[model samples]
Target chain A: MNFLSFGHYHHDMCLVLHRSLQLDNNSMLSFTLAMRDGQAFDTVLSRAKSMGLAVREGRLLASAKPVARAFSIQDPDRHWIEIILEN
Target chain B: MSNSAFIPPNVLPPLLQKFAPLLKRKWFRELVLLWPTLTRRRFSNKTEDYGVFKPSLVGHFGQLAVYVQDIARSRIWYQKVAGLTHSRTSDPEPHPSKPGWTLRACYMSAKEHDECLVLLEERDPSGKMSVPSGMSFFHFALEVEGNRKEDVFAFAAQQKRDGFHLNYGPVQHNSEPPDGDGETGGNVACYLYDPDWHNVEFCGAMDTIENYRARYGDKKGSDRN
Candidate 1:
């Protein structure tokens, strides 16, 4: 299984922090999205709740460069998504 | 000299330690001035990282990826609908979680569009395809540059005629809400489902999270400065 890959976004921009995970032995390629579209981070969380999306465990992600508040969620398709905002 | 001074320096002094490394760096500005002689001297071909933050890492919209149960079927569907051709597959990346194995990946580009879509799949020993379920990625948009959004809609309509699953319309998505006044500062978009359930979208706009949020969320305005 070699076709699983992550879609890299536009090159001219930036993400405050990022990380990835491999959930499948051969066919699955997944990433925990700690950053989002230009919307504010907390607003994303609140909107997610309003949409009835499940928010999983949350913890402070510590990095020397930037401090981030993060949480996880599972979509209808069972894909786990992590939302993060740098504080 | 005292015992401390007797320890003759092999490395630079503490104050020089940091700048010494910078002076020896390949991307260092002074090195370019020295390169005329340095290259002739054949000091070293190795290049240095100018900064830890690199725009090249995220440079360019590389690929719009989606999940597929059967790659061959997906390929045929894309070819028929969007006139996308199989550009190439890259060497499998080392599986992040699995040991002694690699992940398979390929890039397919449209003749009309500069960007490509990444198809990720896996095959068993018996040659049967295994697809992972539940992709978290909402949708990816293709920029309309020289190609007109009207042309995109026409092509999408034709795809429907050609028997592809045209899930949604060549309609203007509302910028503020799920359904609102149709003054779309957002994107003129159409949605399609591949052979698998991967939701693919074509938008007549450039790459922006504002576009993504407009389609997927309730927010009308962008918070980014």
Candidate 2:
């Protein structure tokens, strides 16, 4: 078996992906990525749209105040991937 | 989120509270261990982390272990779809609990992170080895750098070429509402399943807990739900 390693992206963290024989939709809910700033966030969002990927935009609220601007997309496995930029 | 979640509340009743100190003593633990049946019952009644020593933690997300039907097939799938680099493969060894059985594992890591995803398989040609049914476990995620839009797009293209598809998202998600007092913040992400049907997530941007506190105020953001 060939092993592919993507260990160069970050120094302190590694993203681990797992697979089980049976599909338990609830096993993994979602994971998030913190953008460096709003510009980078908007750039990625725009790129996703250009690729024709379905994207949903919204605001993350706390105490009825919008705390962050965000968007989401689903993978083939039906897991939520949320991207956000702090306001 | 607030540090209050990490602080345990006074859940022990007064009667049991008195014995809590005794339970921590080595001698008392030894006494309980003397009776095998009682030892099992005693430990089972307690939480899994009870009485265990803990070292200072950096709170880093580490490796994930996945059981697969075919290590070779899964390895190729992960490499093509997730862009993980293959690190090493371990020699087959005897299964600890099963006689005449052997286990082999392959380790794969992301670009620069020390953490890895491990693939384990039973080296049985008879095909009687059991793979987990995907219950009792949730999905794991990989954090993509914000500037890696091309890389993310490349990954998506490869998946399409391989006849796989994104399960969902590139969508945004928020923390719980104020009434829930959950952590405040949000993220943009997408998801997919590996060959063995395990969910894999790739995310672009997320907020830190400190950022959450900054945006929502210390009190509202600190309380983790």
Candidate 3:
């Protein structure tokens, strides 16, 4: 199993690891986690782009933690996996 | 530079042992063998002395940094209720075009190896305000004076009266832990909001402070009670 499979919400980092996928030896996978705060999403996306990962698929879904907002993102790997958050 | 002594140690396990034979494959063996050792030397030069690590970074590994829009209000609330003390307060980094917005903030510490929290706010005209949400970054609880359930409960009550209420037990008290752990005994907690409305809590097991400390040394654990 891949070590990164543990999808957890780190309070300090303010990030939720929504999903994980193990890739073949020569491939890479990248997806975005939705922000609970609507305002922080754009800032997070900009950071992701600077890392050379592209947006492959994304959508908005509602959440109910402390504040509620939708998650959206894309996978940059060849498998083209998707993650969705729904209220 | 001509000596064979520069070769890296052959530390591969049985499964990787096959790769060692290739080191003697003429051009491949001589060229690739030195690469790992060269990389090791460069890495060693840049490595930090683990024993000499800064104390601030050592204990503050997992500490939270909460950026608030209002610095003064957040500082007062954390000091008065959360039992955290300021380590330092500083201004924000300046901008190039404008005169620059000042960052007014303070650092607060907790016990054990937890990181010191750096509460910050930008003092620029464009500075944004904080919106409290249960889902937002939660405020961390400080270790309280006693470990008993009553002490935490009482402190929670006092906070409520002092106008610094936090989210603790539900009004119905349904949140109390079910009893009878050999160590835990029971659980009680209190919760409140900071100036920014971030959720903060103080909780205790029905045991001595020393007992709890001995059992969980400033690390997260499954709720025993």
Candidate 4:
């Protein structure tokens, strides 16, 4: 429905959260966090699950795409938090 | 300030209609409505102060997700209108909303940055998304190439030349100055409508965010992603 960015908060993104709450209205789709080089993405993924987040690898809506060394977590806010290796 | 300045005679496509009402809202006017107040103005309390600390989420801001009626068509439109390029696409999958349809999506970026403007589309037999309100997302702003007022006008000029109408602006906007002199020191912004009727903005002079952060450094803290 609303988006906040680390670089700054100009609402770089927005998605309308419809009354039906259908997955269709997801606009501010995904926020990517690039880990420092050599920071095993698995460690982050593992820790995410420990924090009660559902972190996983797959092509599902909330899951990460097949981007290299990337994973996705369905955070409590229901936004897709994607972790990817810095190229 | 003719009526045509607000809504262009309905001569344009239906998508322009989607963008028209957004222009009428007071929030938009407040941003561009530089002080000296003919009437009261609303200011966004969002301050933008930040420290050099490495956050747990240590990555650049990424792209935004937008749903469209057609990915391929939308890609070309972004190119002509905003100069964004089609970068990559994810595999086509089942419609997350419609049971019988399949959907495909792609990313559009102005440069090779970590972020992108994603356009998601589904095959609709009805030629419409059928998703209640036309688009769930209201609008998103992208920093223009130069982040200057000239750049904003040049981009708007090019859009017009390319036949992509800017629903609003290319106008300079600023926040009320700390001294309250209304010196016009704010971001320059403009608004447009995508083919799918979603409002999109190409803005320059984005220091308003920095101004916000300076006044209010990362207050929400770890709660942010």
Off by over 4 Å in 3: A1-87, B1-62, B94-102, B111-115, B123-135, B170-187, B206-225
Write candidate 3's Cα lDDT for A1-87 as tens digits. Answer: 001111121111122221232322111111223343333445555555677666433321111122132233344323222222222
What is candidate 3's local distance difference test score?
Answer: 0.39
Q: State the DockQ of every prediction.
A: 0.03, 0.04, 0.02, 0.32
For A1-87, candidate 2 gives per-residue lDDT tens digits of 111122221122322233223443222223344465677777778877888877866521111113366776655655455566655
Question: Which candidate wins on TM-score?
Answer: 4
Query: How far in Å is the alpha carbon of B90 misplaced in model 2?
Result: 2.0
Which segments of candidate 2 are over 4 A away from where they belong? A1-87, B1-56, B96-100, B123-127, B147-162, B175-185, B218-225
Cα lDDT of model 4 by residue, B1-225, tens digit: 011122212234667545544443445444454462445543333223334344334455454566665666778787877778777787866754356665566877777563366677655655455332333344566778877778987888888886676777665443332211121324676777776666677877654456755633555421221
Task: Rank candidates by TM-score, best first.
Answer: 4, 2, 1, 3
Q: Which should have the higher TM-score, number 1 or number 2?
A: 2
Q: Please provide, for model 1 over B1-225, each residue's C-alpha lDDT reduced to its tens digit, 9 standing for 90 to 100.
A: 001112112212446433432432324524543765565743222111112232221113323445465566777777666667887665545433335434455557776543256676654544455554433443455544344557666767777787664555565433233322132333556666555555566656432343343444543222210
Chain A TM-score of each candidate structure, as shown: 0.48, 0.61, 0.32, 0.52
Which parts of model 1 are misplaced by more than 4 Å? A1-87, B1-59, B89-96, B100-102, B112-115, B123-129, B144-147, B175-185, B205-225
Best by DockQ: 4
Residues B1-225, model 2: lDDT tens digits: 011112112122346434433433445545654685554542222111111133212223334556666778878877876678888777776643346766666778888653257676764545465453444244466766442444455555666677775655434333333211111124444566666556677764454434544544534211332
C-alpha local distance difference test of each model? 0.45, 0.49, 0.39, 0.55
Please identify which of the two predictions, 1 or 4, would achieve the higher TM-score against the true structure: 4
Candidate 2 chain B weakest lDDT stretch, 10 residues: B1-10
